[model samples]
Target chain A: MSLGGDWYLALAAIVFSIGAFGLLVRRNIIVMFMCVELMLNAANLTFVTFSRMLNDIGGQSLVFFVLVVAAAEVVVGLGIIVAVHRRRAGATADDLHILKG
Target chain B: MTHLVGPLVATTFVDALTFTVAAAIVLAGAVGVVVARNPVHSALMLVMTLFGVAVLFVEQQADFLAAVQVIVYAGAIIVLFLFVIMLLGVDRREVFGRENLRGQRPMAAILVVLGLAGIFLLGFGAHWATGAPSVAGRANAAGPNVAKLGTSVFTTYLLPFEATAALLVIAVVGAVVLVRRTPGARGPDDQDDAGLEEHPGADGGDGTLAFGTGGEASGDADDGDGGERGDLGHDDPALGSTHERKMTS
Candidate 1:
């Protein structure tokens, strides 16, 4: 038998926390996006864990959809980042104040 | 001691060892992603974490997910991230010592710690998996992992599967539209127009059209400027008048 489900859940929680911390603290938009990926991966791990624990294929199916959404999000997000970089050469997340009215 | 530890540890030694090693790798990579000053290093660390997760997926009998995780997350996603990083030339090391907002780092750390503690408490204290077992299908049913997953996707979750296909198409189109450079399009900073006009040769004479860089001159030659007067003839008349004034003075 594999290890208890709680072990995987605890690990996922910790990884998610680390990702959240990085998202909040990091200034660079790219690093922040990486943090979002980390969080999503952690959630994926949790889903797989529950899939095994419950003997349900639905959890894994949800993970598949999540993977698709993540890919779409990354594509659009990186395109936006490229557009932003073109406008201001070295602009960080803090420097994006064009919408401030 | 045997009775207390028996339920927690895996019955097989290999199972326990694999979980221990992969969990360690995942945690270490996650921390590295957060701490690495360079975005490239963070992306590499994310790959490591993804690989470790894939290993765990295999261990949990999620063989199809394991392969997809490796191929999609580590392969395509990380390469795209590195590509963007290199293309934008933002791979330089970031200064982590300086904090722009006062007490923001500490506050974020504290919030994450509290949230983690809450998750742990809620998870262990309550019954975690309280649901009807195998609502869609049994994961442990006697079949190959891929076949089982494919059957479920095509039968039970067909609508969502089709929706994801549409989502992917939309994402592709959206990315192209966002990154595409339009001629005479003004950004928030209007100063780039002056810079491009002054140094037309710097951008190879077509700087005003192609993203203000003049890297390529293949598409949309209708507004392509042949000389100084052509430079002022932008699609936007207001912008054209502004360029005319700048050229005259």
Candidate 2:
């Protein structure tokens, strides 16, 4: 089967947009984090698709770095979440307006 | 004969169908993250979404990204979220608030639609078809998956790699320091003291004052007595005479 076309790329883009919507509109912090992951995965999907389409190793290499950044993001973001939870007892992202200035 | 080829073709078709189903599940879970009310439940749904995406990645021949997505995103990060949820003793009722801003949700929906339209237009409508060599040639020629990634990361991208490590170290140190209570930090210790007082007669080694009125009086007595023995019980109505006996004896 011939692979790497615009259809799957469009689908990934739409999914990523939904995720961005969730990240924007959602008040819950953890769900927002999940949404962020969704967006990242969408980008990764595009990268892999294009990598296959072009037969370039660079896009795949970039996917590796993106994965690395995503891991680091999870580590740091969850650490912040835990810190906020410990300090506030329950870290609702809505409650994160302590520094709203 | 042709009958044997039919079974093999059927198996491959079934595998494709299975992969499609997995992809659908991942998409649904992404939607669930947006729609779910309970943050904990949403986080759990996100784990399913991540798993589905990993399957899709595997289907796309991105084995490394798939494993990293599952292991790092689903296993470690989501578990950290669950741990925080449990540790903070978050009640379900406390998480949801019924306050939709004026026209915010609809506006957000509209913006998302527009952004997606833009991306689709750019992705599909744009006439930029630059075909390079086919994947088969590269896959046959390179023959080293992890080694290629490692070489690029170490040699060409080494500076950024080390910088990322520094960033991670800083993040770890910052989170640790943020969560850690200093020796004299009053808030966390005060809460712990309140918890200690909840279980009356428990051996709180630091002699934390009890919570209520009698304990307040005891605290005052201890503060005034200039470092005497049995100071915590000195002002208690029950222990007053016993302390006096000890002082006289």
Candidate 3:
């Protein structure tokens, strides 16, 4: 098939679905965090593809900010994981039900 | 060879080949990420996916983005993931198909199918976005895309750009504070208990004498141990130099 903006956007969508699936099904919080990252990447790809198709500078510039946001998110999210793991031996999502009644 | 009349055709062929390879790598890596039982393996798969996306970016002529993708996403973000994986010791094989919540798998499956179908519809079923014939910039074809990106960022989008820098600094400092373990921060009781778990071999080696005479071999080894030892060593019935030497701190 010809590689077009539509093709790349479709790939992004599929990848995003896979990430969301993993996020929902997996109990391991670390893996869930990985899934979140994957979703972010998929979004980034879509942004670049749309930018290329539109011939606009704005989409690509937006991608630069997205990268920074992703980096910051990684730092914070993994830090939370470390903190949770320190208190509890396991990082299972099941163990994080302390707030529940 | 020097007078070849097919330079443009050669580039198109090369682009098609690269796209095929990169797309395959990305899809395979995405599958690997979900299917892999071990989180560490999943992390490696994520690296593969990130690399493939970088290739895709380069193909789109986003040279600076391709570099940033590899450097930031693969280099830093995924490295942080691996660190958490190793530190947390969550690398053990995940119990497959085990759902802590009822209907979680079914829900996820339905959501996945819906999501994919909707996205496909957005792409094909509808004539979707109003993408023009082609971008005027064409990235490097017009001028250096990065230079163009810099000029816009500093001009039109300066406020958000500065805000992002501030956001990153806060994230860095906050993460450091959250993960750091300062001495005497936690009480002696929890500290000693955590110490026992920290050194499993020490717990097993020091075994019965570590906890209680009636302590089970592996039971005391796994549970919150080092309590009796802490009491004996710190302020209780002085158990002599041997017990004191055994203390972690």
lDDT of 1 by residue, B78-111 (tens): 9999888755546545656767789999899899
Q: Rank the candidates by TM-score, best first.
A: 1, 3, 2
Superior by TM-score: candidate 1 or candidate 3? 1
Q: Is the docking of candidate 3 incorrect, acceptable, medium or high quality?
A: acceptable
Q: Report the TM-score measured on chain A for model 3.
A: 0.94
Off by over 4 Å in 2: B1-19, B91-97, B127-140, B183-249
In Å, residue B67's CA in model 1 sits off its true spot by: 0.6
Best by TM-score: 1
Q: Superpose all Cα atoms of candidate 1 onto the true structure and report the RMSD in Å to 1 decimal.
A: 9.0
- Indicate the residue-level lDDT of A60 in model 3: 85
Query: Considering DockQ, where higher is better, how would the candidates rank from best to worst?
Result: 1, 3, 2
Question: Model 2: which docking level applies?
Answer: acceptable
Docking class of 1: medium
Worst 10 residues of 3 chain B by lDDT: B212-221
After superposition, which runs of candidate 1 have C-alpha atoms over 4 Å from their true positions?
B1-6, B188-249
Superposed Cα deviation of residue B152, candidate 2 (Å): 2.9
- Worst 10-residue stretch by lDDT in candidate 2 chain B? B1-10
| Candidate 3 clash pair list | A55-B135
